[model samples]
Target: MVEIDPADNTAPPAGGKRFAPLWEPPPAPTRGRPARVNRTQIVDAAVAIADERGLDAVSMRSVARALGVGTMTLYSHVPSRDHLIDAMIDRAYADFALPDPDLPWRTALETYARGYFSLLRSHSWLLTVNTWRMPLAPHVFDADEAAFRILVDTGLTANQVVETIGIVRQAVSGFARAAAAEIADERDQGTDYEAYWSAQTDFWENTFDPARYPTMTRLWTMGAFDDAATPFDLRIGALLDTIELLIERAGGSGTAVPSFDECVRMSGPDPAGCADVDTADA
Candidate 1:
């Protein structure tokens, strides 16, 4: 038997130092029952609601209804409406199928853009998906990580890579949302964009004085042509080209910008030469 020391609270009976309190761990967390709400399932239900009725239609109550659970149950998984939207955005991002790493930066970036566009199209409410200043989720960080790796390999600084990724991500989502809005507008009006443009042109011709607006008259005539380049292509292309130029100047290369000849060729193939048909801002 060990000797006990009166002054040492931890000493053993025979004089070996006591170890019970010194080595004991705090108790494990054990509440009455495990949490009933599954966070993943709650987010999934919210995404389904957004897909069916757009993001505006999504509400905590609505999601709860869809899940056949009480609103309080959802709150157990997600804190607020904003939190739900954030979760929905991440869930939508989870749908992206990442490109191969072996591809060149240009190809990889384009693949990323296309994959993102497809995701937005599938989840049209993506425009409302929050990309807060500080994103905490896995999907958000995964994209940033992929972009950082790809751009870093391209010889860009960390800040440059981050800036470039932001612009690219915005461009892809903006393009998709713009296209979705245009399509939605046309569907709501029960007429195609071309028909609406014709009506607008008739109004323009009737309201404007030709002598005072020669330039407008000239543009109107040229714009009516099926062979004319559409404004959508021009604007979006111009914006992209401007960014490409910036990147080129900043040390990047091999941008796949379309040549004028290529544009002409593409226009030559389409029935209306949709190239000439402006999307009224798509």
Candidate 2:
């Protein structure tokens, strides 16, 4: 079962006015018996269903059954399926731990990326949702705020700040999505990424034309195929290096900031282990 979000915010969300009803729930029914559950409870139940089975299994009827309430009873709380999903996505995002304001900018992003990637893995069903249509819910905006806050004080301009955050977030999103899709599909497919790829071993070892793919052939010969996965920080640290160059180009302190390796090493983990960040404490 999924843990329920403890946020009791009652203020209207700042991003989307039409989504206000979800943020500001309906007043308790004054004419009839009060609702058996509030909107949060309904959303929590639906999230549970989605987590266990998948998003496709989370409909009004399925959630109603999980909550031990009738289908119409859910309608009173969640006006529609669209409303429920928008709430669900935000609820999952609420699990993200925002960076502490006192930390250095690179450290803050490290904290944010690790936490966000774990959240995506936990709720991999989120990958299937049409996120383009997802409402600009409170937590979503808060996440965007956390990213902006990290870079706002840098000498980079507004456009640079936005692009930098977009790039970092997309990196986390794309990598985690590739990793999660393999795990989630194992439910019905009965084979994971490693197992599925092993099927092509014979062709790769014998039939493949190494002359046509020189670099890949070299990598394969070096036992690089022994573990095809690239470590996360190797890529992210390189990104940080580029961003540092950008900061220097903008007349800000670039090399003054500790490298990802330096900060991470000071924080007491093996540098390579940064890729396996367990952000429960984030």
Candidate 3:
């Protein structure tokens, strides 16, 4: 959750900074004939290319070619290929609309986590991007802030909330990476899971001694890895259950905290309780 100053355009020193600059919208076209394209269009075209092909296919020239623009004109909208990648990541985050914060804390968290997991699955290439080089874009921060709001009301300290978020994010990323890799492997091999597993089982049974690998053989015989969805379901449930236990350990939930929707409604020119809740200690 490293924060980047939106105004800082200079790239971070190599291997020193953990994040890049937060993405900002490109400036409006000069007053004259309306410009044919904008940053959003350029980003969308780049994302489509990456989605169909892969991240390596996304370059300034490729994006411009897709958009029917010159490479230099594309550069004017997005300064570099790295900058275009930052926009693509942010756009993915923006697609996951924030869940209703009025739901119970656990419910809200489940909604958010599932949405994030699905987003990564859809854009499997995102798992290949170097996360340390990516900045906390506005949409990404919005999702994080929403989660923070929910956890803060559950009687956890600011530090605890931050720690919990770190755990949740790591879990989601790890799961997504495994899932995406399995998908890509299946596609490349042109084989379904059952076929792949059957081949592996045949080889193992033929080569390995049954007595030496009794437990492994027993599990394989019983079809332990048969269902693809069972593992995901079990793991997601365990993670959420663990968070619920942590909330209880942190002195249980507070009754006075307002729902996120309520806080927004109450936040007028003078943000009464909203500001206090945002900065309050456990």
Candidate 4:
């Protein structure tokens, strides 16, 4: 696990070079004694509510009530619900144990992917939040920086690096969502994935049509699904194989970014071409 820099906890990953605090302090409550509530207290309360009751349950009034304060008072620290959610999402990201940059690229990436999936299961409400609004914060950058650094020495091009990591993230999110839904179903409806699937055994044995899903029917007959990894490690292994293929396409050249000529052809006299891009060491 990458030792997260304590200075920038609970920030979004890779927002940009210019980072800003989500909300400034409310001027220290310049009258009637000093204020007691801080941003951490408010955000923590909000996160707890969301984890237990879903994101929609986390309103300003609800958070304030959790903290034994008035709804208006929360605005002093959080500014608005959007800002509150921004903090909440970043805090959740902070729990991600960034992979060690020194590990093999595949090892580091697999470690990172597993950690992210576990974190999501712990805070499944995060899947419902519109993470597009998540802010650019240091915590966000630190985790991303570690993950990117892991692939820095790989024979993948700059474009390949971006695409590779994006694929890994999507795989983790998709798998985590599916697994989390199983737990949710069990909790909310007393039927987890296995139970729900088993409940349909009668239909599968008596009335299920094999001609419409011949492949699935065959796989089912062969017990293909029963021997699968719990979270389907097969999926991640396939993703790593795809990343390796991209690296092999690099021809074993240590070149990270595309050649200048390649960039020029892609840019074609655009003024804000390479200068605007962060193709490391290019």
Best by TM-score: 4
lDDT of 1 by residue, 16-122 (tens): 12222122312433676765557778778889978988877777777778888777776555556666666677778789867788887766777777777788788
The lDDT of model 2 is 0.74
lDDT of 2 by residue, 1-282 (tens): 432222222233455554886567677778877778788899999899888888878787778788898777876776667677888999999998889988998889888887777777778788787756667688888888888889866777657887898888778778777776656577679986657777988997788898999999888789987755532221477678888888778875332333356548656655555444443332
Better of 1 and 3 by TM-score: 3
Q: What tens digits encode model 3's per-residue C-alpha lDDT throughout 126-154?
A: 87888665656777778778877768777
Question: Sorted on lDDT, highest at the top, how do the candidates line up?
Answer: 2, 4, 3, 1
Candidate 2, residue 92: CA error in Å? 1.0
Name the TM-score of candidate 1: 0.60
Candidate 2's C-alpha runs over 4 A off are 1-17, 194-201, 220-235, 252-282
Instruction: Report lDDT (CA) for all predictions.
Output: 0.63, 0.74, 0.70, 0.71
Indicate the residue-level lDDT of 44 in model 2.
94
Candidate 3: lDDT of 127?
77
Instruction: Write down the TM-score of every candidate.
Output: 0.60, 0.73, 0.73, 0.77
> Once all C-alphas are superposed, what RMSD does model 1 give against the true structure?
19.9
Residue 36 of model 3: what lDDT? 71
Kindly report which residue pairs in candidate 2 clash with one another: none
